[model samples]
Structure formats: C-alpha cells, structure tokens
Target: MWSGPPQPDEGLPTGLSAVSVPWKNLGPSKGHRESPGSLVENPASRKEAQGEEHSAAAPLDVSRLRSSSMEIREKGSEFLKEELYKAQKELKLKDEECERLCKVRAQLEQELEELTASLFQEAHKMVREANMKQAASEKQLKEAWGKIDMLQAEVTALKTLVITSTPASPNRELHPQLLSPTKAGPRKGHSRHKSTSSSLCPVVCPTAGHIPTPDKDGKELSALVRAAVEDNTLTIEPVASQTLPTVKVPTVECNNINTCALSGLARTCHHRIRLGDSESHYYISPSSRARITAVCNFFTYIRYIQQGLVRQDAEPMFWEIMRLRKGMSLAKLGFFPQEA
Candidate 1:
C-alpha cells in the first residue's frame, strides 16, 4: 500500500512519532476505569481533590457549639435559680400566714374562756339573789300568818267581853254632861251648873285630866260604872284629893285613844240629817267631800299600820298632814286662785 508519508510511531515513548489509524476501524469497546491516583497527575488537580475530601470529612465548629451549649446551660441554671427563689419566697409567706392564724386562734380561745367564766359568775349571782328573795318572801308570809292569829285572838276576846256586858241606857238619853261635844263650846254663857256639867263630860276632858262623875241617880251611876268596866271604853280609878274624899272618876284608857280619835273624826265628818228625812247629805261640795274622804282614808291607813294590819311602819298621820300643808302652798296645791 502506498502511504502518504513515513508516519512517525505516535503510540510509542515521548520521543516516538504519531501513527495515524483509520477512525472507521476503531470499534465500540468498554473503556477502562482509571484509579484516583492515576487520574490526578497534576499538582493543581491533586490539591483540588484533597481540598474537597477535607471539606467533606471536616467536623462542625466545635468551639462555637461548645459555647452555645454552655450559654444554654447557664440560661437553664438561671431559670432554675429564679424558680427556687420564688418558691422560697412563697414558703416564707405561707409560714407567716400560718403564724398569724395561730395567734388569732390563741386570742379567740382566751376570749372564749373569759366569757365562759363571766357567764358562770353571773348565773351564780342570779341564783343567790333568787334564794334571798325566796327567803324574804317566806319570812313575810310567816309574819303575816302570826298577825292573823293575833287579830283572831283579839276578836275572840272582844266578842267574849261584849257577850258578858250588861245592857245600858240609850246613848242619846245620856246627859250632855256625859257626852262630849266635838267642837269648842260658847265661853261666856255658862252658869256654874253648866260649867260643872261641861267639866264632867268625858269628851271635853283633856287627855291627862280626870272625868268627874255626873250627879245622877245611884242606879244610873251604877249602871254607867258597870257598862264602862265591861266595855273597856273608859278607865275609872279612885283618887284621893286634898279638897275632896276618895272619888271615882272616869278617864280614857290609853289603848282606846286611837278608837276614840277615829270615832270623833267620824262624828265631825258626819253628813247633815234632816229631822224627818231618812236620807243624809254632805253640806260641803263634792270636791271638798272627796278631799275629806281622802283624809279619812289616810287616817284609816295609819290606823291599820298602828294596829299591825299592814307591814309598813306607822308615820304620825297628823304630822304628815301638817308637813303636807307646810311644804305645799295653797296656790301650788290649787287650793286658792293663783291671781288671788
């Protein structure tokens, strides 16, 4: 065959010439895989490959990560510390609350004890007062019963005396000398006999004075003496005088003074009776009569006290009346007109 020229051997060593092969003759064939060492022949390429490998194998920035982790741990520790502080503060507050409650409970218990003791003392005092009142009431009841017994005995004795007494002449038929007038008699118009008669009247006699016997018939005198002795209304005693012989004169008994005074007051206050009329009428106005009746009632109360009918002490009725008159002016008491 005719070659174009003498071609150098290209497939030989660095000094060998290139040998041209026909491109159509090169068939399809598997290419051989090259090793990394064989592929990286240039210094620059080797450096590049080593750089990539280092980049892939290199670990993360350990210093930065360690710093971040430390920061996170510090933050967590701070949070924990804050929580602990809050818990301690809450515990302290709870302790203080508990102490306050304890103090309040102790104070309440003390007050309750004091109240209980005071209530107990008050109950005891009430019981004692009730006992005293009961004792006093019982004593009063006994005294009242004793008084009733005494009154009954006195009534029985008086009834017995009345049954034994002799009947006397009519009270009206008794001489004016024997009967006493409530008011003062005329001073100038009396003869000696009239004066003697007035003196002999028992009602006119002073409390300390002796009553002379009336110069009446012996039968009448004996009857009067007998009546007086039996009635216990008057006491007759014989007194020897320098001028006169032993004479029996009538004197008011001390025990009968209250009865005599009451009778005298009643007589003085008696209603006016017309001679032929059965009805009696007071001369004074009703108001004045009421006042008189009040006075009589007051006297009656005093008499009851003196007679031991009531428990209260007996004040002198006349003294009280005088005190009332002195303390209360007529105008103030409405007795006289204020203008007057």
Candidate 2:
C-alpha cells in the first residue's frame, strides 16, 4: 500500500536526495500506484551523469599531462645547454693547448739557430788560429834549413883543405928564396937559376906589373902594399923582399901545410857572393856584396896565418879585419854596424 508518494527523503540518505527520485512515484499516481520494483529507469539520465563525470576527470588528467610535458621540455633544454657549455669549454682548452705548443716549437727553432751560429763561429776561430800557427812554423823551418846549408858548406871547405894539404918530404926546405934586390950572395948548395916570369911570386898590387921599391917615389906604393898585406887584401906568396924578413914571421913546421888554402877560401867566398847575386832575396843590397867580399879577404888572411905564412906583427891587423867582417855581417843581419 502506498500512501500518496513517499516523501523524497523517506528512504534515501540525506545527501543523495537531490539526485535520486522515489521509486514508488516513478510511474502512475492518485488511484493507481506502482510498486518499487516496477519503476522504469531512464537511459538518457544515466548516460548524461556518466558523461559529466567523465568530462570533469578528463580536464584534471589533461592538466597533469601538460605540466609533466612542460617539466620534461625544461629538463631537456637545461641538459642541452649544459652539454653545449661543456663542448665550448673543451674547444677553448684545446685551442689554448694548440697555441702553447706552437709557441714552444717556435722557441725551440730559434734556440737551434743560435746554437748553430755559435758553433760555426767557434769552428772558424779555431781554423784561423791553426793557420797562423802553421805559417809561423813554416817560417821557422826555412830559417833552420838556411843555417844547416851554411854549416854544411863550412864542413865541405874544411874537408877539401885537409885533402889538399899533404906533408912535404922531411929533407925539402919549406922556405924557398925568390928574386929580391937585397940578396947579398948565393948559397953554396943551392943552384942559381935564371929568373923567369913563372918562377916569380904572384903579387897583387894596386898598379899591375909595377913593383914597389924602397925609393922615394915608390914610398907611397910601399905603404899601400904594406896596408894591403895588413888588411888581408892579397894572398901570401914566398917573400921576395928583404923588408919581409925584418917583420917577425911565424915559425911553424912546414909539414902538412896547405899554402893554397887561402886561395880556396877566397874562391868559396866569391862563389857565395855570386850565389847572393843570383838569389836576390838572400842578399838585400850592394852592401851585402861588399860584406861578402870583406869576409873572403878576412878568411884569406886567417888561412895564411894558420899556414905560418904571415908575420907575427900582423896579429893586430887580423883583429881589425875581424872587426870589419863582424860589422859587415851585422849589417847583413839587419843590425847596426856600430853594434857589431
């Protein structure tokens, strides 16, 4: 039995009364009533409710999805920026390293050039020093060779003198008398032979073929002859004048004596003079020739004295010739004549 339509709140909960309708009032009303079981449901109303719920949930889901998508995009952008920064930093570092390496290479090349230049300079200095030393040594060697040649010549001259000076027989008289104006008488044992030009002693006079006598006119000539003998200008021959006997002659054993040694010495000296003339570099000037001639004359005098052919009084004159020869030698050697 239905008492009119049940109130809306009769069986429903308080909050659901607005949306839910009473099942007893679903159909016919007044004298006819419908049972709760016979209530007809509306398909359109259910469909509308479900559609509204679906629409509300869809909006919230869409907002959440959009926020998530925004977060993902922001994260991706940040990561890309970080990666780009890292790449740029790395590129900058690599560029700096490349620049540093290039600078080092340039510096090394410069140092190498400097070292090479210094080495070349050192080598050049060494070569120059060596060349200078070699030149000095060569000059010394030439001087030594010249001295050796001079000594060898002296040795050869001595050897020839020894060979030529053979002792005469013991019985033969070493002193032979030549033609002289002062001879008093002939000896008993000696035979007097006619005087010939060949038997005459060779005399070097200022005037050829003119013999100086003790007469007043020939006094000057005599003085000149004496001076020539003292100065060692002439070779010693057998004394043909009584004046030579007045001078103290050196007495020596006549054996093993070379009378021609003085002549050979003079010849050698003359040969040296010729050599000096031929090789101009060896003798610088005419003074050098004069010097050589003086030496020859001095040696000739020495040879005569050694052979006991000169007077003992000629000792002083020998010293004078030696002094003159020394001066000439000094001149040739580039020293002062006075110093010599």
Candidate 3:
C-alpha cells in the first residue's frame, strides 16, 4: 500500500514501535512529513528548541543595554560641565564685587583722614592765638603792679614826715618880714640886704604861728625837711622866699611831643655878668651855672611826668627822658649827675 518509501507506522503496534525500525523510516514518507498537518511534534522537544533560540539572542540584548549605558554617561558629563561653568561665573562676580567695595572703602577713609587733618590745623592755630593774647595780658598786669608799688613807697615817706614835725610859735610868725627875700638881679651898690635862716641849711619853714621851740620835735622837723629837700622828694617852698628866682634858659613843657634837642653842658653868659667892674664880685661862670641849671631842669621834667602832664609817643624820646630822670635823682643825692 506504500508508495516509494514505506509508511513509517504502517504496521506499528498501537502502543509501541517495531523492534527493527530504521531511523530513515522513523516518520511518514517525505511528502507527508513535510506537510504542516502531518508534521509530528512533542511538548518537551518544542520547549527545548525555543530555549535554545532565547539563549542565542541574549548576547545581542546585553550588547544593546551596554551601548545605552554609555550614552547616559556622556549626557551626565555634559550636565556637569554646564554646572561648573555657572559656578565659575558666580565666583568671578563675587570677587569683582569685593574688589569694588574695598576700593570705595579706601576712598572714604582717605577723605576722612584729610578732614581730620584740616580740623587739627585749625585748632592748632586757634590755640596759638589764644596763648599770645594771654601772654600779652599777663605782661600788662605785671607793669601795672610795679607802678603801684612805687607810688605806695612815695606815699609812705610823706606820711612819715608829716607825723614827726614841730608845733607852732607866735614870735616866729610876728617878724615874718625878716624872712622875706628880695628880687635877684645885677645892680652896683644896691644897698638892701636880706638873709634867710632856711638858706643856711635846706629847711622847710612852718606856716604862720607853726614854729616850734628848740626841742627834739623841732630838731627832728629840721632834719626831715633837709632830707626831703636834698632828695627832691618834697615840692614845698620855704616861707622865707615869696617868689623863686627864674633862670634865663627858655623851657617848654613837654606836651605830646616825643623828640627834642637837649643841651648837655653848653653855656651862654648873660650880659650883666660880661660887663663887670673890679669890685663886682657877683659872678658865676656860664659853665658853672649851666651845670646847676641842668639839674633844675631835669627835676622839673620828671615832676611833669609823674603828674601825668606828658603823654608818651612812639618816637625816640624815651631814652632821653629815662636818662635825664635818672641823672636828676642821682644829683639830688649829692652824687655827680650822669651825661644824658
């Protein structure tokens, strides 16, 4: 019943294959075996073939996964680079801001330093001016104190004299005409003779009825009067002379004028002294008279100064005034008057 090849299971047992079965005759004829409907299969063998195909595909899948992992790593590297660039930019901005702030702070500090220096200079100038003014004021106060001390000494001397003088007498007041002095001039044989007790010694006579008897008080008064007149400390004229004899030298009161020529030892003789008879004994040489007159003139000048009659000026008269005053004071003490 079979054609070219025997049917593989034509007389096969129902439960088992023949014992002499050939491997080439294991299936039906080739034409039937190749048919989809007649193809023989077992469950276990199909599973085994599918497992082999899966095993062969696993290496390709693993290769594809590895390639995807490499791509992911590359993208992560790009992200990291971008982040690093942003950080660098922020750091640069921060550094720039810090530098700018430092510069601004330095400028402000410099300005403050300048302002402080200016203020200190101004303060120093003010202090110097104030010190100068204070020093000037102190100098003025010292000068005023010196003047006050000198005046006080003068006052004390006057008080001492007034307390020690004598009491009055009546006979000395009654014959006061004998003490009267006549006019002084040049005349031959002018027969009036007048002498003063005060002329014998420098004595300041008492007022009318104020003469004392010869006693301790009287002697003390005479001594004090002599001392005062010799020292030129007292300005009182004796009661014996009514008018003081005037010298011929022209004198001008020192007003506000500061400079004037003062003759030291020059002399000019009067006409009365130039024409003289042999018996005319009233004569004083011009040089001798000038020496006496210079003393008188210097004392008068100092009195005027003490009375505040003259105002000092900025001119060169201060040296002259000081010299003359010192000379006059020394002359009153019976010492030689120095050259002015």
lDDT of each candidate versus the true structure: 0.43, 0.43, 0.42
TM values, all candidates? 0.32, 0.38, 0.42
> Any residue pairs clashing in model 2, and if so which?
none
Quote the lDDT for 1 in model 2: 30
Tens-digit per-residue lDDT, 240-291, candidate 1: 1121111122332222111111112212221211111212111222223333
Evaluated with lDDT, which candidate comes out highest? 2
Which lDDT value does model 3 have at 132? 91
* Winning model by TM-score: 3
Expressed as tens digits, the lDDT of each residue in 102-209 for candidate 2 is: 999999999999999999999999999999999999978876775675565456444322222332221111222211212223333323334333443332221224
> For each predicted model, how many residue pairs clash, with residues at least 3 apart or on different chains?
5, 0, 1
- What lDDT score goes with residue 125 in model 3? 92
| Per-residue lDDT value at 267 in model 2 | 13
Model 2 residue 51 lDDT score? 51
Listed per candidate, the RMSD to the true structure in angstroms reads: 22.3, 16.5, 17.7
Candidate 1 backbone collisions, by pair: 8-17, 9-17, 10-17, 10-18, 10-19
Q: Tell me the lDDT of model 3 at 171.
A: 33
Question: Model 2 scores what on Cα lDDT?
Answer: 0.43
